[model samples]
Target: MTTIGIDDMALATAHHVVDLADLAAAAGVDPAKYRVGLGQDRFAFPAPDEDVVTMGAAAALPIVERHGAAGIRTLLFATESGVDQSKSAGLFVHGLLGLPPQMRVVELKQACYGGTAALQAAIGIVSRNPSERVLVVASDVARYELDSPGEPTQGAGAVAMLVAADPRLVEIEPVSGLSSAHVDDFWRPNDSSTAVVDGALSMSAYLSALTSAWDDFAAHGGAGIDEIDRFAFHQPFTKMARKALRRLATHTGAALDDVLQEATFAYNRELGNTYAASLYAGIAALLDGDDDLADRRIGLFSYGSGAVGELFTGVVRPGYDRVLRPGAVPDALAARVPLGLAEYRALHAVQHPSDVDLTTPSVTKAPFRFAGLRGRARQYERTA
Candidate 1:
């Protein structure tokens, strides 16, 4: 019987940003088609020297520096954009952050739901071993073919969380409801670099899975929809989340207020979709943006393609404000270098070749970067 939850959290986005309006103009579509219709403004795009591992390490380094990594017993990385099939991305993060070698390191893949799965596993481990600390990092680069239907949702980022007993930010309630199905709403084949998504079907699947999980959660004595002080959803886009929340509110007879939806979607609109990192990023954004959320009940709904959904609740711990700095999220967003449509396409077109002994140019300004492929192994380095 231990109280386990998120102790500290941090996030990182690529230094490059692409405005949706520019994309719309290039595609011969109205700006409102992306800004108003889809509820997205811009999204982060990783440079040639950045990928999931580099972004993941960049996010985790701040947490490790603040909390110290000596006590961490488990490091779990979740992503759909893994650099290697066999090797865990957590290992790279461990090395970059200079963590102790004694901890268990592994990667989890369940699409966007992977992060929550890792978090739940960490909670279980910490409950069994009170002294153990777990670090869960979710990072991904959502890419689709150029001019494809799913291109506008593309984004790159990471979110890292340190989980332990008596957490300073939020305490997980342990009660959760989950639903899973073998649906090919979205997936990427082994040989394909970009994902194939059934947009309409994926939206349907997301809403359906969410409803099932929420229903099960309420049946198992979870909090009522109205009773929760805040709600955060795994956001592929702001409009998608808003639609799902409205549907959930209608089904449960709860009030779907504009203020709540706006609060939850504040980060998604700015960041686009981080795939596995989206949910945690939303939570971090909420913590950083609102000062009144302290000691409030917050509900989280996580959904992944091909497809899994989970509903869980946590209480925002007292002094949560001290764990996050005000304006930190906004400042990171503001620091990105804006990319024009042509510039974005050129950057996106650069792909790593399998046979060449290539070394990536020092394109990314971040401390951690993907050095390139040397002997078919993904090489990464920490910049001095």
Candidate 2:
């Protein structure tokens, strides 16, 4: 069997951020509730012109530019915040990145687990056809009603991964474990822009799914918790992930060391919840912070509300550190303009109208922007 896994990865976040302190002050709450209790410091917010497709393209463009898009045989876009009800966002991303038109393009939605599902499918394809390559992108804008309990967890970003044989970043193990249940931990109806979540129920569901998936994984001869060098979970928030890890540790009777815990959540603390993109962003964060991860094993736990869970393993390839683009994530995060309470509210209020003459906001400085609607079709353009 061909060794199939991630060849390269990249991330993109909105150029604007809202500090939790500002949000707390505006809500008449203590900052520690968000910063300490939730383990979130800041969250990214999109400009008027940014959405899942644009953000997905932004994250993928760099990979296509560096590796060339000619070899790509498939493109899978995973997101719940899709712009169209009929069309797949992958088509838009393929056009935006100038990828080969002959490739298979499709979209997947199982909430946040969609990305992991795409990755797993991509690996299967590549493993069968050694010459084929697949690009999987997970992008989302997590939103909730204003002043709601889920507000601080809202964020926008994307993560793109190129999967192929002899991958440079990591080698995905063929075996994986998955658990699924029909539950309403979180859901967004077709008519609603914001998601409805039962926080306590969601947390219970997440930890339960993690435990079941891990158990199934171990039953299938997967690595034990003690043997894994790093663990990455679908991060709705940092504290949630930490709680899940603690649960895992207790289940396995393995100690969850401070370094491992810190490495798992550093990015989620700053970026908040990115929905489909969170787990991969956590992987990228671990790679960015640790220089000695090459050849190490990583345990990945992916969960999506309404609800599905997967546990998988991958081994970092030698010299995997060199595959990460220097200053990509750091530069983007550093460039973000922190928003005050009023500015944040104003930004959030700017919505895309379906039948109006919408123009690109001058404030949108991201490489890719949603260029508004034309003939009821969503349009996007690359910034000059």
Candidate 3:
């Protein structure tokens, strides 16, 4: 059997921080709406120099180090925050990770579903050419600008998945997916700093996509909503995901019992939404929870815009615990230095220096930093 698995995984985030309580006050909303209602606590605060590339590389480094450079034949970087319009982020990541040269490097986009799409592509490459293994990295810095409705929900982080045959993580199950062209749910204009989202409409669109994907998957003999061992979704926000859950459970009569919605949201609640990294984060949360998922399968629904969606499944591999980050995620979430409103505002106002000298002082000990810009090219340095 052609089995593909995750060899390792990693994650990283910004140093400075914004506590949700203060962010809620600034947005003129209740803190619980985000902290409790949305299931968030902190939103990672990125420096002017760092973006998705740096964060993405940081998350993958720990895993790449564990697996080494020999077997990797493909490097895929998935992100909505593309640093360059023409260039692939994978090239930079390849250099950052010190991988072998004989590999395919590419970048993919499909909203939050980018990483999952990359993962699917990697699986195909491995299944067809058994000698090859693929590295799928997802990273993003979610920013909604100051004072926008999405400001309080913004977050930054990355996750890396090492996919290879006869794997140790989980096997990707075949499932069908559905997509819709909803102009209002989410979008980022060329010149816009903040993403535009129609909250109510986007919530509606997510459920609609879920319905269609579930129907198609079920028709293909895939697991129905009730049969899924765990449901991992894109963490747009606790409230938004909850709305989709209500719709899903109501439609299928299945209850949400995997991870406590509060605890699941807590992971993202403190970190905010990682854009393309959100769904993978959800998967990590479910795996880390106390659910009886052994011999069971997980269903993943990925959605992104400009609009695309996919329903996929994976089985939890034995010894998955050994490869997990092991309290690293929770530790990272807890180590955040909550910033006062004034500090957050000032930090947010700072922009990336035109000629930043990357070899500067270490602002945070998070193992990731923006080294500098060379020939107008951004550089990311991994300290740990």
**Which prediction has the highest lDDT against the true structure?**
1
Model 3: lowest-lDDT 10 consecutive positions: 257-266
Model 3 per-residue lDDT tens digits across residues 1-384? 777766567767776678878877777888777766666777887765467877787788878777777778889999888877788987888887788888889999877878888888888888888777788999887777788667878888888888888777677775656665755688878666568877777766777888777777777888766667666777887666676667667777777655234434556766788878888887777667634556567777787765667777888887777666668888876776667889878877765544554444456665666676676677777767
User: What C-alpha lDDT, on a 0 to 100 scale, does residue 217 get in candidate 1?
Assistant: 96
Tell me the tens digit of each residue's lDDT in model 1 across 128-200: 8889899999999999999998999998899999999999999999789889999999999998889999999
TM for every model, in the order presented, reads: 0.97, 0.97, 0.91
Clashing pairs in 1: none
* Cα-lDDT of candidate 1: 0.89
Model 2 lDDT, full chain set: 0.88
Which regions of candidate 1 deviate over 4 angstroms?
A: 258-261
**Candidate 2 segments exceeding 4 Å error:** none
List, residue by residue over 269-369, the lDDT tens digit for candidate 2. Answer: 77779988999999998888888898999888899999999999999999998787766787888788888888888777666667776677656677788
Clashes (candidate 3): 8
Please give the CA lDDT of all the candidate structures. 0.89, 0.88, 0.75
